[model samples]
Every structure is written in structure tokens, then in C-alpha cells.
Target: MQIKLRLMVALLGLLSVAATAAELPELIFPEGVGVNIHFVTEHTNDLDLIAAAGFKFVRMDFSWESTERKKGEYTWGDYEELTANLEKHGLRAIYILDYSNDLYEERVSSLHAITHEEQRGTASPQHPKSIAAYARWAAAAVEHFRGQHVIWEIWNEPNGYFWKPKPDVKQYLTLALAAAKAIRTQVPKAKIIGPATSGFDWPFMEEFLKSGVLEYLDAVSVHPYRDPGTPPETVTEDYKKLREMIGRLAPGGKKNLPIISGEWGYSSSTAGVLQEVQAQYLVRQQLVNMLNEVPLSIWYDWKNDGLDRGDNEHNFGTVTADLKPKPAYVAVKTLTHELSGYRILRRIEMDPKDYVLVCVNGSGGCKMVGWTTAKAHSVGVEMPFKSVHRITGMDGFGKGFTPKVKEGDLIFKVEQMPKYYAFE
Candidate 1:
């Protein structure tokens, strides 16, 4: 009954945010949006909220230490509830196999030992035995969730603090390869992706690539977090560089491994960016990742993890801990709904402050999303469409407007926040 209620709510959202068209497929990546959810001890409202936002995927980091705390003693309390709820609400999972257990350690005992920092640490195993144990645990997890088509990301931010002590390219590749083998051994068709680094750690990733980590990966994963003010389009160059690196350094199939922005987002308070600006960042970054051909992009967080809005870490959520919506939350729903079946045709020619990206579908129809990247504006844009409606964004919906062709160009007003312009 709860799932039914959730689906009804998700369907109703389409009435307000969706375009007039036939029933479309669920939004997947390269064109769709998804969110990272931390429901370990939180309510199931996160799942409901994700479905309501029209997101198709939910990424949850499955801690090895938490599940298999005492050698073989397995507990599936919080995880089961979370995964079951996600399935119920019609969202898929990207389960991250990460962190370390005391039972699996060879050298870094203190690093692998669970502590207050285990929640934030990525103390992965070092020894062959410990690595094999992790692989076994990962395989067990894959077996348990076999039918759900869950994507397994080897670890999170291995090049960053998650690795603890310091990042070691050899160690990360070893664990990743072992986990991949174990997952494959258990579920041959399972999808394994990784090198889930924090940022573009050139040395770490290049070494991994040169060492052939791609041999075990189905997709290349990254956490491309950046400054809040950076336009999403600007980062396509960074991804392009990563692709070039893969081609130059890795083997044949490795060169073509798909990139998945498995985790990337801006924090309202954490990054010192305004909540509204955070909302705009959401649209821009997701669009940028999609345009760059990153098949999947997952926003880091869905709601504030703690009550301290003043703290940067606690303020990443698009909603408050109480389930209240932030501007970022609404923006996610609006941006995703407006993105239905739209492929980025090309970036239109525009002025400094103004930016225009055109998207079109089959049947020769084209639409655009325009924004000033800086602030709201009344700049004239050469939109080829005769008419348009504001589908969604942080900005309020605009009244229907008609564009006039001036000098062989249809001109319309563009604003700071993006607005969808569908052609008649």
C-alpha cells in the first residue's frame, strides 16, 4: 500500500512537470538523473522523495564491516529495509562495496579496524587473504541482490581520504580486481565498475589504467566534485582528458570503458554556496555530465544528514533532515521531468553571460534550455522555436510566450535559471 501511494504521487508529479507526450520510458543516465541516498538509520522518506523527483537510480554505499562484523556473523537490518524500499518505489540500486573489516586486515590493522571514523573511512584490505575475504563478502552481497540488477562500485573515493593513511594504486587495483572476480564468480552477469576516486587524481587513475584495472571494470566510475560556481559545461574538458588518458594508457577494451559520474553534487552550506545557487548547480552539473556522455550521474546526497545546517558536511542534502524540500530538491524534480527523452543536440551560439543548449527528439522537433550562468537577464536569444513554456527549474514558471523571427532568427528572453523551451 505504501508503494502504491508512492507510485501515485510520482505519477501525479508528471501532470505538473512532465511535457505533453505519450508514456515514456523511465529516465536512465546519459539523459536521466539519480540521487545518492544515505538511509542507513534514516526514514524511508528518502526513497519516496527520490521516486517523487522522477530519478531512476539510488546509490547506497554498502559497508562490508557493518554487514559481516564478527567473521561470519551477517546482519542485514538497515540495508534490507533500504534496498526493499528502493525496489518498492521503482528505483534501482548502485551498491558500493567499500570500507574494511578488522578480520580482513594484513598490514594496516588500525586502518582496517572499525572505529568512530569507520562511517567516513575507506580502510580497504591490503593482504591477499583479507582481500579475498572482502571479495567473498562482496560475492555474497551480489548473490543476495542478484535479481535486482544492482551495480557494484568497488570502493568510494579510493584516492581521497576514504582510503585512509594514504592512497596506494597497487593496493586499490588489487582489491578491485579481487572483488570483481568474486562478484563474477557468484553472479556472472553482475555489473562491476570502479576506480571511484574523489577527483581526477591523475597519477592514481593513470597508474590504475596502465596496470589494466579496466580489465575488471564494466564502466569507469568517478566522483567529479568541483567548486559550486563552476559551470557544468566547463568540466566536459576534464572528462575529455580522462577519456584521452584511458585511450592513451589502457588496452583496447579499456579505452572504450564508459564513464559514470557515480557521485557528484554541491552543498548548500558545505561549499558556502547559497541554497538557491546549489539548486542551479544541480541542473548545470547534471546537464554537463550528460552532455559529456557520462552514462550515469548520481548526486551525492538527497537530504541533510544532520541538523547542523551551519556545518558544511551536514548541509549537503537537498532537503532538511525533517524531510522539508530545499530549492535543490525541487530543482532536481523539475529539471528531470523537463528532460524527458531529450538529447542535447548542440550548444547554441550565445553571448558571454548567456548560455543556450538545445535538445531535440525524433520527428525533427527541437527544444532548448537557456540560462545566464550569472544572474537573471532579459537577453535576446536566437531560439528557433515559435513558442515555449517554462517546464521546470528554481525559477518560477513563465507564462507562455511567442518568439519573433528577427533577421532569420527566433528571439526570446533568457534568464539566470534554466527554462525549458519546447517547440510547437
Candidate 2:
């Protein structure tokens, strides 16, 4: 009896040591963070700067019209060049398998298709032949880039103007299913996600999810764009609703289905939003998404589309058309660099309109990010161990301010702008 009891205690001690050696979870930033880009060859220099900014992924359209000008042939010269640059910068590609070919549908190109029903052509592949052709192209693209770890997303924002004449969940599903099946069959290991719907359009998404689309998807992708006045934290409820829907609808009672913020951003145009406000939103949006357990968060428009200051679409970029860094760019760089290789330990506190998250790196270092959308107030943040620390602002507001320490808790002034506290 004594010998058996001693063996049990030794086994428990070994288990405890193993648990302590286990690694902490990884955060989504610095790996899953990305931006939308319109060009591949045009902005060669910008690619260098973007990678330097610590953007690990780039979401670009691999349009059918551009790749397949011929009936059944695909010329991947542009995409090949794009992938090469992506590899050169140590960045991954979330290449969108999207848009309709003019020859396959009508002479009207998807670029010319407008929101007006009459003006809208088949913005996506519609005809049977076109659908089959698109599936083949998707499989071929996945096969071509097999070992490169590319994420092939089916159709961008089919629930909105991007769907062409009108949004039809049934039609979109038909094409998405075919393409998904083809990629699954041809390249079984390929990472394919679908129904990249615009916003949290429940009606559209519910119908799409009902079709067992989640069975073929590695993750659900959404462009969660909100009205200019809506705060990023408001997305928490939307994510909750989405998770419930996905849980009820996913095949074989799958739980914890991953959600990706595939594309979302704020415009800095005069009629849209201010650049300074855009920067704050950028950090807040990413942090909110992170807290919600989103695996990937992509910001739309890597650079401003045009010189038109008043055009909302022309000003969503992190950088200007001339490749000048905006406050939004600096905010992202700071977030990624500061929290590199760090993962969320837990939410210390989330009420009182004050948000505090504790993050830890593999090297036993701890950091806290705190902010409040409400009026400025002081919040007590307890550290892992009592120590001297440094504070840094998000977009250059307050830096190097030593907070008052109380009972092993650091008193921080939480305000609209998110700030990072690194324990020394």
C-alpha cells in the first residue's frame, strides 16, 4: 500500500511539470492581420513597406475575367507575379477567387456593374458553363499554389452590389458549392472558405448556412462593415448571433466554428470619417475582434484608391495614394510590433465601459491593453507580479505616463484612445 501511494504522487508531479512547460496560445495579429490591395506589379515598392509594417497577409482578387480571357484556358501571369512578391516579403496570400468573366456571362464587365438592378450585370458567374468553368479555375489555382499555404475564398460580398444585378442567396450557393466541391476534390488539403457576404446580413447568411456550406468551409468569412457612427465593440453581439447560427447549422454538430473578419475598414474622406478617428477605430476594431476570438482580421484598402479627397471609396487606405503613412498605418505597426508573438491570457475586466486584456508572450513577459469608449476614467489593472512598467499610446496621445500604483494594482487612465502597458 505504501509503495503504490508513492508511485501515484510521483506521476502527479510529472504531470504538473508538463503542464508548466506547455506553450501559451498565439494571438491572431502579426500572422493573421492583413489589408486589401488592388495592384500587384504597380506597387512593388509599397509591398516592401507593407511587409515592414508587419502585415503578414495580403487579400487580392484573382478575378476570372483577368485570368481566363479564353474559353477554358487560364493565364496566371499576374497572379504568379503577385504570389512571388508575397513570398519575397514572407507574406501569405488570401487570394479571392471572385468576380465574373465578361465572355462567360454578358459583354458587361463586373467593374462596370453598378448597384442599380438595371445596370447590374451578372457580377458573379451565373450560367452553368460559367459556373463549371469557375470551379475548374478555382481547383486549378489551388493546385498551382498548392504548397504556398494560400487561402482561397469563394466570391467577395455576394450579398451586396458585388453580386451584380441583385443578391440571390440560392444562385450564390449554387456557384459556391460547385467551386468548393471542385477544390476539395482536386486539392483536398487546400484551405477554402466561402460566402464572403457583406456585413452580418442574417437573412442571406442564414440561407447560405442552411445549405451546409460550413461543411466545406475551413472558416466563415464576413466583411463586417458598420455605419460610420457605429462603434467596433457593437460587433460583439453580431458575432454571438453568428456563432449560434453556425453551431446550429454546421454539419455533424460542429462547435467553435472559426470566424474571419475578411474585410473591414474606415474611410478618411471629408464626407466619410476623419483620419485621426480612423486610426483610433483601426486599433479598437482589431482589439475587439481579437477579444471575440476571431482568427483573422483584414482591413480593406492598403492604400488610398484615388486622389479624390471627398470620395469615400477613394480614402479607405492605411496610406495615401502617394504612399505616405497615415495615422492608421502607424497604429497598426505599433500594435503588431508591440504585441509580437503575444497571446491573450484573459480579459481582466470588460465592464464599466473600460476594457482591459492581459497578454503574455512565450518569454514570460506580460502586457495589458486598456481603453474606454465612455468618458475618461481610472481603472485598476493588477499585474502578474508587482514591477515597474512603461505606458505607450496608440496614436501618439499620452506616452511615458507613470500610473499610480495601489495594492499591487496599477491605476491607469482609460480614455477613447487605446493604450498599451508593458511590464518591465
Candidate 3:
């Protein structure tokens, strides 16, 4: 009995010694954060809420038709409030130069959908004369908004229904080229970004690259939407795929292109996604993009459109329809606060169900964003962590929770929910 008791105690001591986090070296990089904001006009608190979320930039619409309703007649009423709010908040703007003007389109397509004056389809004119007319509006708008340092994206999802009457790559490229030239001519210091396709439309992107439309633009942008129920970290592979595509498709043979995930988001109330799950994925998506070195990852939306929780379209926003923040808002706010100044060092691959993102800051201390692949499971980590602190991945605001720990072994209850662990 004594021999057996001694062996059990010895085994327990060995297990504890193997459980702590290993101290890792710092790996350095720089990353930026941004989000897509909607309904700034309707909600008085939208801009302030966005600013409070720690977003450094916003992707907002500067609709063309609304600005120049009459020929050569400029009205700045719609934009004055927006620019004022942006300047007040110190958040940069990526203003989309979008859609069709009634004066320029000889024949309007009924298939086009307009969401609050944001003409989403068949925005470019078919007539050559109308192209020149639209160019004037493009130039005038850029000139008016000059010195605000707002980025101009020629069109939104031009390769999808956002173009309308079936996406015409040739005509869309012509429209983009004309707009790019006009903006450069009118506002020399303005930054232009585009080919804002709905997803990876290979043919559409190829046309732009082969036609040298890339040379006229500042950054290549895409809305890399994933399938429902797919992991948000799936973007890491997608990002790699995009770099490969740009290297192969870009002009001058393998030219390095600055890629921007200008718009990306997952809808809650879709599939079996819980509200809490939505919040978890929101943080994961942004961190995945950041760790992969994508300069900007704009969450597709800022607020829910209505009070229907079951409606996926309305539930995409971080805030509820009433502008009350959801769990996602808090999760994002926390992520941006902690990871904003830090850079991802590497991705630690363990089993098929466990994933880890290694990160470091200016101080050389390291932190990790880790989550389980399948469902929840407890895992033991053995490493050289001097001191380890635990924060609940989704809701770590003011409360600090206890995680299972031993002498050299720390046990974490890993789940689909991402948890941040510190090793310094």
C-alpha cells in the first residue's frame, strides 16, 4: 500500500511540472483596423458608437446621384454631416464613389436595387456620352471632398449584381479607368481603391489585371465572403490564395499587390449560429485577417437594420437595431483594445481541432489567441511561461476567471469560443 501511494504521488508531480506555457520570442509586424458603417444619416449615435469601438477607419457611402441631383449643380448637405462627424471622431473615411445618376443613364435597368439611395446594380452608364457626364460628377465630388484624406473606391461589388444587367467586366473596367483618371486629375492627393468584387470573381479580376487597371489604382480590394458555418479563420487560407492569385495575375510578372479585405462579415441568425457564436466569430475574423497581414478588415456592417433577431440580413451588425450594442460589439471592442498595437508572430498548429495565433508587442512580451476546432475540450499546455494571466475570449471585460492550472501544466477548457492567454 505504501509503494502504490508513493507511485501515485510521484506521477501527479510529474504531470504538474509539464503544464505551463512556454516563453516564446517576439515576432514583429504592423496592422490596421477598420469597419464598415451603415445608416449614419438615420442614427444620431451611429458615428459615435463606431468611434467608441476603436475602429480607425470606416467604409461609408458617398452616393453619387444624391450629391449631384441636377446637372453640374452640387449639393453638399448629405456629406457635410458625415465628414464633420468623421473629423470629430478622428476616424478616416473610405468613401465609395458609387451607382448611377438619373441624368447620365439613357435607359435605367429595373433589376438594380437601391438601398437608401445606394444604387447597387447597373451603376455604370452604357452610353459613351454618359460616361463623360458621370466623370464630371466623379471629378467634382473628389474636388469637393479634397484634403479630407478620404479614400475613393470607384464602385462596390462591380463584378456582382452591384453592376447590374449582368456584370460587364469590359464596361465596368472602362468606368473605373475613367473615374480613376478623373479623380487623379481633379484631386492629385486623393487615394483611389477598387475592383470591390462581391467575392473572388476570377474573370472579373483577370480583366482588371490584364487591362492594367491595377496600375491606375492604389490598392486591390475584395469582399471575401465564406460559406455559412465555415470557420472565420478559413480566411487565412483565402488570404494565402489571394496572394498567390495576385502574384500570378498581376502585371510585370508576380508584382506584389497591397490587398485589402475592404468588406467581410458573418451574419448571425443564419444557420444554427447563436448570438454568442456570432460575437466569437467577429473577433476571430478580424484577428485572422490581422495576423495574416491584411492591412484592413472592414466588418460588413455596423448596426442591425431592424429588431428581428431571426433575420440574417438585419442581424449582421455589431449593434442591435436600436443601436444598443450586442455581445459582438463588446467582443470587438476588447479585441481592438488588446491586439491593436500587437502583431501576430505565427500560427501554432496542434491537432485538427485546436488552433493558436502567436502574437507579440513592442515590449517583447507575448500573447496568444487560441480556440478549439470542434466542440469544447480541455487541453494541457506545457511551456515556459514566467507568469500567465487568463481572460475569457468573448466576455473578459471586467471579470477575471480562473482556468485550471498546476506547477508546470495549465489546463484550458478550449471551445469554439476564442480565449486570449498571456505568457510573459
lDDT of 3 by residue, 130-197 (tens): 67777778888888888776778888987766665657888888888887888788877667788888
List where candidate 1 sits over 4 angstroms from the true fold: 1-31, 106-123, 362-365, 375-408
Candidate maximizing lDDT: 2
- Give per-residue CA lDDT, model 1, range 1-424, as digits (tens): 2244334445534542431121111222223477888756556666778788778788888988889988866787877777777778887788899788877663332243213243333356877788888888989988887776678899888876567566777888888878888788788777788888877888888887787667666778888888767656667778999999888987875677678888888777754689887887787777777667665788878888787766766878888888899888887777776666666656777675676777654344456777776656555555444343333222323334554446645454565567766655
Q: Write the per-residue lDDT of candidate 2 for residues 210-326, one digit (tens) a residue.
A: 897677778789989988788788899999999999988778744556788999998999887788888878888888988898767889889998999988889999999999999
Return the candidate ranking by lDDT, descending.
2, 1, 3
lDDT of each: 0.71, 0.78, 0.69
Q: Could you tell me the lDDT of residue 184 within candidate 3?
A: 83
Candidate 1 colliding pairs = 270-312, 303-317
**Model 1 whole-model lDDT (C-alpha atoms):** 0.71
Q: In angstroms, what RMSD does candidate 2 have relative to the true structure?
A: 6.0
lDDT of 3 at 320: 81
